[model samples]
Target: MSLFKLDNVIQNYAWGSKDSINQLFGIVNPNHEPQAEIWMGAHPNGCSKLGTTGEPLSEVIDQNKLDVLGGYTAARFGGLPFLFKVLAAETPLSIQVHPNKRKSELGFERENAEGTPLNASNRNYKDPNHKPELVYALTFYKAMNGFRPIEHIVALFEEANITTLNIELNVLKAIGDSDALKAFFSAIMSLEGERKEAALAELYAAHARPAKTVMGREALQYSKEFKQHYNDDIGLFAPLMLNTVELAPGEAMFLHAETPHAYVQGTGLEIMANSDNVLRAGLTPKYIDVPELIDNTIFEPIKPEDIRLNPVLKEGKMSYPIPVDDFGFDILSATDESKAQYLRSAEILFCVEGVATISSEGQSITLKPGESVFVSNNSSVYQYQGNGVLARAYN
Candidate 1:
């Protein structure tokens, strides 16, 4: 009654890898379809099914809210507050930002008042909940997070010498702060006609040559790589303006609300608030509301170390100091000395390496790499009794 096995959904999106998930999780892919993400929570869009009875996780939760989620969490969130996913990106995702709680509520309400259908391509807000994510790399993961320092951004643009962007570039150089970044970025993303062409053309030509600075070389390679998929989309220049970092296996990063970011490549375990709202900037065919994205984005520069997390290790567990209340993550090393966790909120345990058997009261479930189990708060306590690495997701 406390432990439930989940039959998760695999999202097949174009940016996914056809082989990575299969290779890492033993998930068979005979059709060779792109396996983008694995949905492992009670989200209505892709609710996981109970392995034993095939009932949707949402229904199960709705029917037994307090029993499943515990008194405090049920009272606070009304249901599950987070969604868990295994995301594998073979290419760049859309350049995008998530709004904060207040912005998300306003946008969702505004769209509803206008009668914008939720599924409409132009609809921006999906729910009134903000999505703040923490990703732990399963492989070498590459991403662009936050903005580059204004001076560095100016230097790159100055070096690229895009004649069309001269005015905006000069404006940014003159102001040289967050406000200037906002104005400059907004203008650049909103570029039209002859000016857009001239700027993009100059950027390609400049990067197409041998590199000048180390940062320039990175910009050159990423721009070329992005072009392979998006083909000169304005977002392709993201590397030139944003801070880029590669997270090694077992490394982690946090993407907070209003932060501009994009996943460039590789696989990771991502946990976020149970929301789908997204405001796109570039890198896809998706509708981009540039003004909304700009409004929601934080135009501040951050070093790779700022987003790349360093966890606190204690008692065979690693915990991230997340700022949000919607979700919490911990990695438990289960060996002969495994400690039992007293469940105060609902939890999901996913085995990532080796094999482990989780036991509660008198029941047990064996999990292999990629296998996950949903644990109800009614269980109160549970422990793992094997040698393996397990990622724990909770409220």
Candidate 2:
């Protein structure tokens, strides 16, 4: 098979940006609702379609898994292992983490046995696969990822004069990183009613004061934003406990399983394992599974530099290296003076900027900004040439 155009699925979540995805895709928003994500994959929940035909891409792949997903991938993952998405976040997302494969399988089975509906809003696990993701910033992106160093978090609490949390802070200081994190997190998530509100009010007032450090300032800003959206929810205090990271366009970060994270704002290209399972802790109206989140979360401190995936630049492509065998991600840029590079895989390409013509042996397709195409492995080798940036996802 040659290259097939894809009709992507757009998800309009409440926290999505109003203009980013629409502007990128050149679509006029009639309702002006938030356009959160454009999903391009075979996931049953939000599968992409073959352009014009309206046939689900998942069905097409299942009919010819060997040709579309390749033999090894089809045998191992049973389908496409990765789900590609364009995420535009105007408001902060929930504080959430994903389980590992084993935990996911177990949780999924348990939920199934309990007769929990698959579409239940309170469902914790949606699939029995681990979701490891990477986000490539399309604009200035801000997120809170992983845990901050214990000493730094302690100092932040001290500086902010959060006396109500003194007991939890003391416990954190007394124990090791993991136990301290669990204890501190448990204490925060356990706060109820008036006590939670009172604590949040105090934290909010403290955050209003000018912060001395960069992280502190960012945390305060995030806290204010979270408060505006969620009122006095305890999740507003997450910024103070997690590492705040800001990524410029082209920079990327990898999120492994059990690493708690929340995307604060901005648009990005995200790719993850083909799973919808999300273990949310707070910062949203969704179900909060405190024990599950705490049990699965990795409690180690993560530096911004440590989580960053520096791209390896080739002639015309920049590959973001990850440890997972499920998928690979790359940014392919072509110019008038560029050479046509060969690609060998069942690949999906989305043009984020400029116009580009991608050609296989005797077939070719032109992709404009926000347009995407699926290239089957059956196409021996294809090359693209134009002046634009394209994101490629493949196994």
Candidate 3:
């Protein structure tokens, strides 16, 4: 195959945005259901299809793995190793972590041996691959990523005057270790019944007062929003403990396995290792596997600069660097001076803005906004023209 049009899958999750995806794709939903994600890969859970024919992309890849995917990619990953998505989050997602490869394999095997149903809400691991993700902000995006510095969290809590949290905060301050952070986080998640309700009430009252610091103010703002959506949910306090990340358009962040994260609000392009094994801690009506989450979560503090991926401009493409062999991503902007680009592996190109014409060998496809095309590895050389922004995922 040279280049084939892909019919993507749109996931309608509760926390999704109403207007973003619909507006991007130019679809008007009469029922006004949330459009959470538009998936553009061969992942079994929500696989994309060949345009008009309704043939599954996964089936096509399986039948011609070596030709569709390069020989090296096919040998290493068996099929497509990456899943691409356009994610729109209006409300906060669950506080969650994904397991490393070894842990994921172990957990998947254990659950399978225990006869856990694949569709069971309690199931933790869906596949044995570790999910390391990169998010490119399409709009102003807000998220909670990794643990904040222990000292900062303690000071925030002390200033907030939450007497209930003091004990756990004190333990964290005293130990000053990763284990202490785990213990403190665990204590917060374990709060129950009247105690949990009281803690939430205290948290709400604390945010009611004017915050002294910028981070404190941010925490208060996020907490207020969280409370509005999920009243009495203990996970609402997560903003106080996790680093709040705000991404401008064109900025990107990479999330490795075992990193605790939640997308607070935003629309973005996300690409990750093809896995759906999420171990959730709290902040959802879904299953909260506290023990599993704690085991997989890394307690190390992550600075804002650490997760940010600075793009390198070369030719007309801006490449986002990620330290993974499973996938490569770049933003291709075609102007009048743009030139032909060569593909080393199978690639998926999505036009986010403007209009672009992509040509491979003798065949060409014109992609408008929200349109995507899958270029097979057999098509080695491709050229682009017309003014537009294209997000490309390869290998």
Which candidate achieves the best lDDT against the true structure?
A: 1
Candidate 2: give the clashing pairs.
none
Full-model lDDT for every candidate: 0.90, 0.86, 0.88
lDDT of 3 by residue, 130-153 (tens): 998999999999998898888888
lDDT of 3 at 227: 81
- Of 2 and 3, the candidate ahead on TM-score is 3
- List residue ranges in candidate 2 displaced over 4 A: 337-344
Task: Let me know the TM-score candidate 3 reaches against the reference structure.
Answer: 0.96
Kindly report which residue stretches of model 3 are placed more than 4 angstroms away from their true locations once superposed: none
lDDT of 2 by residue, 1-395 (tens): 56889998889999999899777678667899999999998887799998969989888887888877777887888888899999999998998899999999999999999999989987988889999999999999999889888887887777677888888888888784787788888899899987787787789788779887776777778888888898877788888888888899889999989998999999999999988889987788888888888888888888766877878998878999898988899999977763565544578999989998888878788899989998887775788888998999997
Candidate 1: tens digits of C-alpha lDDT, residues 1-395 = 88888899999998899999999999999999999999999998789999999999889889989999999999999999999999999989998899999999999999999999999999989999899999999999999888988888898887777778888889999989899999999988998888888888998898678888988888778888998888869897788898888899999989989988899999999999988899998898889998888989988888655777889999889998899989999999988775788888999999999988888878899999989999999999998868899999998
User: Which pairs clash inside model 3?
Assistant: none
* Alpha-carbon shift of residue 209 in model 1 (angstroms): 1.0
The candidate scoring highest on TM-score is: 1
lDDT of 1 at 395: 80
